[model samples]
Target chain A: MRAIVWKSATVLILIYVAVMGFLGPVPEREILYETIRNLYFHVPMWFTMTAMFITSLVYSIKYLNTKQESYDVWAVEFANGGILFGFLGLTTGMIWAQFTWGAWWSFDPKQNGAAVTLLIYLAYMVLRNSITDSKSRAKVSAVYNIYAFAAMVPLIFILPRLTDSLHPGAEGNPAFSGYDLDGTMRLVFYPAVIGWIMLGVWIVSLRVRIRNIKDKMYESSL
Target chain B: MKAAYSALAFIALPLFTLAAKYEPVTWDKTFRESGKIFVVVAVVLLILLSVFGYLITQDRRISKIEKELKNK
Candidate 1:
């Protein structure tokens, strides 16, 4: 019942965001103009990605402490979902930057950090794929996942804030300073974030369930 | 000639001032005015719907597999 409710809510909320995001009133700022709408779409991808990665980190810790295969599966699948959203965020950000910042790949601290973060997560996937033994693979990759996530937090959140960045919320940029996101914009922005995060969770759940079924079949075959 | 020149300059001064206020940014006022932005909204919504549809199908397929495994 709760699954159906939340799933339906996700659908409804996203549809609302899609329709309202384009039409919504935005702060008629100089550079952002219509592109401010990209906040609803682009920013949420990062929010969802961050949420997925955080979930993955928690599951990784759970797996390490409990030595449960299911926990490991949950960790990997959540990380997979995180990477998917992270790519979406990165590409959309690039496209937004192309028009607003006059270049596709500005050497902005945030952009560079986002790229490095994705590469680190990609390495996590590669590391998981390379290992052959199940137990050792789970244990080793869970540890690696912890380190990858730890590295990701600083690369994405910390270093970007410390340096001058083209992206908003940097040390010098008064981006998203209270007046930037007007009440009308936040009406759609918050819903968009929640909806996208819910969708990520849904996708991770599906992947985890499938992996569980596959593992069960393997065990039965033996 | 001097008086005519002064009158012409006085008339042109307000015209220059009326040209436009300095706006720091440009926004697509026409895009919203002509309602063409709705077309973009429709396109985005369609793509979102298709993705949701695909996910639904995948969900159903997985549910079917789960059922089959349970029955066995």
Candidate 2:
């Protein structure tokens, strides 16, 4: 029943975001124009990615403490979901940048940081695949996941702020506050973030469950 | 649930008020004026709904498999 409720909430919130994102009033800016509407779709990608990565980090820590196979499954699947969302966020941001910032790849601090963070996560996947034994694979990958998440926070969140960046939320510029995201945009933006996060959690849960089932099948076969 | 109902009510109220208001910005007024923008919204909504349908079906299928495995 709870699962159905969240699934319904995800659908309903996204439906609302889709409707309001297109027709809703936005700040009449000079360069942005209609593309300001991309805020609803673009920003949520990173939010969802970060949420997934954080969940992955938690499970990784849990795996380290308990050495449980299920925790390892949860960690890896959550990381996989995070990686998918991260790439989506990067690509969508590039598209938005091409229109507004006048280049597809602008070598912005935020862009570079995001690329590096994704590379770190990708390396985690490679590390997991290289190991043949299950126990060592889980331990090594769990440790790597923790470090990857640690690197990710500073790379994506902190480093971008230290340097001058075209992306929002720099030293003086703040995201979801000040002049950029006003009260009206919040109506859609907040819902969009929540909706996308819920969807990400749902996907990660499904993947984890499938991984568990696969493990069960393997055990029964053995 | 109550939040969803309130949001629906908010959406319903805005449909009428949206036509009466005008702003000084250049935001594809012609498309909006012609009511063709709703076509775009409709298309997006359709895609979203179909995606939800797929996810829900997948969820149900997985649940069925899990149940069968438990019974076995």
Candidate 3:
């Protein structure tokens, strides 16, 4: 029941963001030009992906402490959602870069960092699938998930800011502060992050439910 | 080598012309040159939302079936 309301709200909020972002006023910087409006879609995907990964990390910690299989399942599914959003973030960022930087996949610090971050999580998936025992898989993958999230923090959030890159807020560059901070971009940006995160949760919830049912069916078969 | 040079020259001429014609494009003032973007965004977003709505309904339906299976 509550899920229904949450999903509805997510839909409405995203629609608002899409509508506003398309029509909203944004400053046309010399280099960025009209493509600066991509700020609405691209930035929010990282926010949503980071939020989901944090949830995944928390569940990984809980799984370690409680040794509950359900917590482990939740951790895996949350990571899955994070990975899915990360793909969206990377591809959208690439497209935006093509317009602004004259290349689709320039070796930007942020871009390389994001690729490495995705690779770390992909290794986590590989680790999970290689183990046959559910308990061992859960335990081992929980540890890897924690490490993956730790790497993600620096990879996506910190390293990009520390190094020189085309991305904003880096060593010498100004970020969203110029236009994004002052403009009505936030009116849509904030809700867009919230909406995308909620949608991620909705997706994870369905996957988790399906997994639980599959486990139940397997046990019954035994 | 001579034929390859001709092929290279053939490619280079059009490429240079294209590069010369390339201009930095900027979006026009909204509602003046193109408010049609709003229409396109609205149409696409509606389709995306409907698909999302279907996923929600599928989640509920699957949950119902799971409950019935568990009860048995």
lDDT for each candidate structure: 0.89, 0.89, 0.84
Put down candidate 1 lDDT per residue, A1-222, tens digits, no spaces.
Answer: 777789889889999999999887777887777888888999999999999999999999999999988999999999999999999999999999999999999989899988999999999999999999989999999999999988997898888999877788875433456767878888999999999999999899989889978987998899
- Is model 2 an incorrect, acceptable, medium or high docking prediction? acceptable
| Tens-digit per-residue lDDT, B1-72, candidate 2 | 979987897988777468636645455465555768899999999998998898888888888888988987
What's the residue-level lDDT of A192 in candidate 1?
Answer: 95
What is the per-residue lDDT of model 2 for residues A26-97, given as tens digits with 9 covering 90 to 100? 887767888888999999999999999999999999999999888999899889999999999999999999
Q: Model 1, retained fraction of real contacts? A: 0.64
Question: Candidates' DockQ values?
Answer: 0.49, 0.39, 0.26
Worst lDDT run of 10 residues, candidate 1 chain A, spans A171-180
Q: Candidate 3 versus the native: TM-score?
A: 0.86
Angstrom error at residue A142, model 3: 0.6
Is candidate 2 or 3 superior in lDDT? 2
- Among residues 3 or more apart in sequence or in different chains, the pairs in candidate 3 whose N, CA or C atoms overlap within 3 Å are none
Candidate number of the best DockQ: 1
What TM-score goes with each of the models? Answer: 0.90, 0.89, 0.86
- Provide the lDDT at A131 for model 3: 100
User: Which is superior by lDDT, 1 or 3?
Assistant: 1
Question: Can you give the lDDT of residue A112 in candidate 1?
Answer: 91
**Which is the winner by TM-score between candidate 1 and candidate 3?**
1
Error of 3 at A74 (Å): 0.4
What is residue A161's positional error in candidate 2, in angstroms? Answer: 1.2
Interface DockQ of candidate 3: 0.26
lDDT at position A19, candidate 2 = 96
